[model samples]
Target: MRKRPAEPPVRREPEAPEGCLTVAIRIPVRIVVLVLVVPVRMLWDALVVAGRFLNDALLRPLGRALLWLGRAVFVWPFVALWRWVVVPVGKALGWLGHVLVVVPLVWLYRYVLTPVGHAIAWVARGAGAALGWIAGGVGAALGWVYAALLTPVGYAVMWVLKGLGAVLAALGIGVWTALAWLVKYLVVVPAVWLYTWVLAPVGRAIGWCAKGLVWLVSMAVTGIGTALYWIARILLVLPALAVWRWILTPVGRVLAVIGRELWDALGHAWRVAGHISLAVGRFLGTLFRWIFVEPVRWVYRSVLTPVGHVVRDAVWRPAAEAARSVGRATRQALAAARESVRQARADFRRMLFGEPRRPQPVDRREPSGRETRTLGSSTTALTKD
Candidate 1:
């Protein structure tokens, strides 16, 4: 209650220092801001408040508006400066959204979806292959059963056909054998007989006649040729021969006289030639018999001694045996014939008288057999009367 009590209570807020930046220093409202960076919004609201306050205090609205316009122009650089910060924040937000959405989706596909899908595909393929193999097996089995069922039927049919073929072959062979036998008896022999008896001899007679005619013609031609040759020789050479003979006739007579004179000389030469020829013939014969025949015998023995023994057992001995048998039989027969001839000579007179005891009167009769007929035979038989 003293007089000093009227002093004002001490202020609680700190006083803004001079010369430092302050809110109410009366700066243009456009230069002041509420947000730290967007000064334009705060300054615009502040300017509008200032204009209303001024319009209320004084009537200078136009001057106030001019001042506001001046302040706005001055504050434009600050508003423009905020774009760098805002644009960077917006771009950062957009990139964050892109990473959030795309990264998880790609990670899920790599870590989970791709392997799961491949495994599912592999399982599906394996199942499909299994089904295919089972179906193929069933189909193959069915085809095998079908083939196996038909095989026995085919074999049975083949067996029946084989049996039938064998039976038919046997029957055909039997029929052929019977036919061959019948033909041999009834046809072949008759045909051969007819040909041999009738046609063969006729053909042979015609052939012989033709041969004789040809031989006669050839002989006639040869005779004519010989005659012509003789005539030509006479024409060409007989005159020369006659001339030579006439010229040599005197020489020949002289030579005959010489021969008569030289008969002893020619006789001695002839005797010598004859004796030499006879001696040569005897010597050559002896040499040939001794040398060639003995050597040939030795060569034959050397080459064929074992061969002869082997062949004798194989072939030649049998042939020699047969020849020896024939010779022995012939010798025996000749000896018997000689004995019989001697006996017959000893009884010759008795046999002659004894044979007169009986006589066979000859009564020749004409042939009666049908085989004596003229033409067409199995040509078979000849009858002798």
Candidate 2:
């Protein structure tokens, strides 16, 4: 046998320490809560009882009647229309659509469109094959022309162009050197002088002015922001923090305690009231039973029961038998009269119109009663011989 593992120790919760303030608040709060809650709880109980009585005696039956009336007025008519009118009309429309539209469309697709499509597909295949052969022949001819005639002409043109290019290169180099010398003296030298002496000084002055203006603007904005921060802190934040810390926190705690006590008192009062109401109801029920119910029950058992039995045996049974016999006689007489009337009608019809024709059987696919299949001679196709 193995040793059992050690059991875990149970942890106990620490109790809350109550102060003078909590103690002072609790007693008066509880007393006040109980006083306020008792009457409210009683009134609530009374309302619940009244509501239950009203629901049972009036509201439930009225709701059932209204429900029946609503079904009769609204739901039943719609149901009848759907069943008798709408369903039949919808079915007839569906059948007509199937016969008039769907059947013809299906027949056209199957018999007319399918054969036309096959013919078009066959003609397209033949045309595509002919076009492919023509394209191949044209491509081969173009390739042969490029290789045999155009190649030699292209080579001769390349040689002539190369000779002209060499002559142009020599003339271009001399003209390019002359233009470079003129551009350096007339345009490049003047542009460097204007930038170095005039534009550099003016740009440095404008940059210094812009930096000073930016520094002044930044300093003004920083000062204004700092002043606003301090003003808001003193005017709004400090007072709001003080109110929250000193006033609202304490008041909320007091209110929370009072609310908790009141809720507990209400629950307690409700339970107590329930017991009081149950006891009172039982007492009243017992009083009523003794005063009225017992006397009525005794009278019903002692006087009414015997009298009812006497009336049933002496008067009710004999009258009931007599009424049944009379009803049977009356029914027999009516049935005989009905038979006579039916016979008279039959005779009158025979005198006026002669005998009605009896239908004669016609030949059909299946065998008749006299020609049914037998074991000796089979009607099945495989065994006909």
Candidate 3:
């Protein structure tokens, strides 16, 4: 019976769905990873290789070419200019400056200025020496004249003054003595005699009367003074005292308090006004700087400076050159005139003196007798004249 039950397992077939078929595919993990990641990695590697190629093939050569071009166009030319043109030009300019300006300045200072200064100094020294000689001669003449005339005159005048003073002193003493005697006799003696004789009794009576009158006047004056004092006390002093005590003191105190308060208020107002004024002033300063000062400065810098440069170059430089030329011409004319004058002076001297004498060195020896006689005669003639 078990063998009959163990009949062949029924071969049951799965039923097919009616709509869509769903298929399941089995893939290896390595294949999935390779399918997802390999293409991205390969693309990244390709990009990197392409970039390296571009850098090596294009960028390196381009950078090198640009460097060489910059050197050829800019750096090399600049170096060459600095070495050949600029350096040589600078050296030549320096030499020209030394030759034209510095050398000329040194030459003028040494040859012209120094010689002119020495000539001026020598002329000054000669003039000074002449002046000194003339001054010495004049001083000697004045001394001789003073010794001959003024000394005796001064002594005589002094003696006359002394004699006159003595005589005046004697006269004054005698006059004073006479006046004193007259006063004693006429005034003092008469006064004494009159007092002793008739004037004594009369004077006594007058003095008594005068004393009585003085007493009466004094009593009247005392009464008047007392009345005036009392009147003043009642009319003026007491009223003034009362007014001061009652009205002026209280009014003054009230006024003082009011004035104090007013002064405090004024002080506060003044302080506030000062603060406002300072703020206003600051604001005005800033506004003025921006509006006036900055614009003026901008105009000066942008317009006036360039205009000044133009004026200097166009007008002043040419004017200065013309002035220098005129000055040079004038100097040449003056030098020629001076030379002509010198020649004329020499000719005149030669004509007058029958040929100008050669200059001789000064001798410091004592003059001979003949020379002394001639000098004295000339000095005498000059003094007389």
In terms of lDDT, the best-performing candidate is 2
Clashes of each: 0, 0, 0
Kindly provide the TM-score of model 1 when superposed on the true structure, using C-alpha atoms: 0.24
Which pairs clash inside model 1? Answer: none
Candidate 1 local lDDT, 4-113, one digit each (tens) = 55777887998756432222332332222212224343344457667888888775867788788887887665566657776778889889977998888999999999
Candidate ranking (lDDT, best to worst): 2, 3, 1
Q: Please, what is the whole-model Cα lDDT of each candidate in the order they appear?
A: 0.75, 0.89, 0.82
* Candidate 3: stretches off by over 4 Å: 1-265, 344-354, 357-385
> Per-residue CA lDDT of candidate 2, range 306-349, in tens?
99999999999999999999999999999999999999999999
Model 2: weakest 10-residue lDDT segment is: 363-372
Whole-structure CA lDDT of model 2: 0.89
Q: How high a TM-score does candidate 2 get?
A: 0.58
True-vs-predicted CA distance for residue 27, candidate 1, Å: 99
Off by over 4 Å in 2: 1-28, 155-255, 284-299, 322-385
Residue 52 CA error for candidate 2 (Å)? 2.6
Error of model 2, residue 102, in angstroms: 3.2
